[model samples]
Target: MTTMTRAELGALGEQLAVDHLTGQGWAILARNWRCRYGELDVIATDPGTRTVVFVEVKTRSGDGFGGLAYAVPPEKVRRLRRLAGAWLVGQQSHWDEVRLDVIGVRIGRCRIPEITHLQGVG
Candidate 1:
């Protein structure tokens, strides 16, 4: 198989993540939402729970950079929270709950890529 570039791998991972979310019946609100702070990988709503979720997607080819658990450190979580706040301020909708989640996509290790989702991360 041909080697995938970093950007291509990331994009593929994000697309897989979106597919996973939609398969779970979640309504995607935004993706790659950008601001001065940074970009949010995905934003979606849980219709059943009436919650708004902010997602951070980390894509990896292997266990490099300490793997998925170490991808979103405390500082990164803080930044994500700030980004979520910035996103919320511009919204006209309200929800019963808001949460931060991390989705780690690991590719090139097996026939199928592995996906790990951590909820309420921050």
Candidate 2:
């Protein structure tokens, strides 16, 4: 069996996040949303709160790099906010809430299924 590459691992993490969110009844507005400024891993709407979520997914192979959650810095949060504003402007939706969530995933050989969702992270 071929081992997955780093890119593949990241893709898996994003898919897992999307699935997790979907299970919670959030409709995916977009994925891998990109512009010259930055990229958002997942964008979804939760009917429960009627809020638009801008999610950033970070995946790591192990404890290295201080795990996935450590990857999100203040600057990245700012970038996400900016991109979300652009997305909102383009869609022309009057969102009641704008939430920034982070999904941190740790991939390992034993497949522990590490996932942590931090809502309103930014």
Candidate 3:
């Protein structure tokens, strides 16, 4: 068994998120996209709906603090929306719709990693 650091865990979660999104037919556009506002974990375009999705991934060892979904607060969602707007301003192409998504990753001892995706969060 091996112990994972916080950074390692976060990276793993983000990678898992990207893989999951790709599996769902989303084309990854960016990862860790940063700006003066904040950072977006994963940005993708949905092939089926032609929607631009701004994904926020939250990884945790357990629910010691709170459930994975609860990690992303209302203010965070608002900020993500702002980030999405900024990202859109820089994009060359257009999307039919813009959505805010949240991917919650939970890692616990002796348990498989749990991933939950909440689309159109805010």
**Top-lDDT structure, candidate number:** 1
Q: Tens digit of lDDT per residue, candidate 2, span 4-119?
A: 89889899989988988998889999999889887888999977987999989987667778745568888888889999998898996778899999988777765566888898
Could you tell me the lDDT of residue 64 within candidate 1? Answer: 75
All candidates: TM-score: 0.94, 0.90, 0.92
Per-residue CA lDDT of candidate 3, range 1-122, in tens?
Answer: 69899999999989988988899888999999999998989999989897999999988777787665677889998899999999999989988999998898887873678889988889
Report the lDDT tens digits of candidate 1 across residue range 1-122. 89999899999999999888998999999999999999999999976899999989888888779867688899999999999999999999999999998899989769898999898988
Candidate 2 or 3, higher TM-score? 3
Collision count of model 1 = 0
Which residue pairs come into collision in candidate 2?
none
Q: How far off is residue 74 in model 2, in Å?
A: 0.6
**Candidate 3 local lDDT, residue 15:** 90
Please report, as a residue range, the 10-residue window in candidate 3 with the lowest summed lDDT. 62-71
List lDDT for all candidates, in order.
Answer: 0.91, 0.86, 0.88
**Order of models, best TM-score first:** 1, 3, 2
Candidate with more favorable, higher TM-score: 1 or 3: 1
Model 2, total clashes: 0
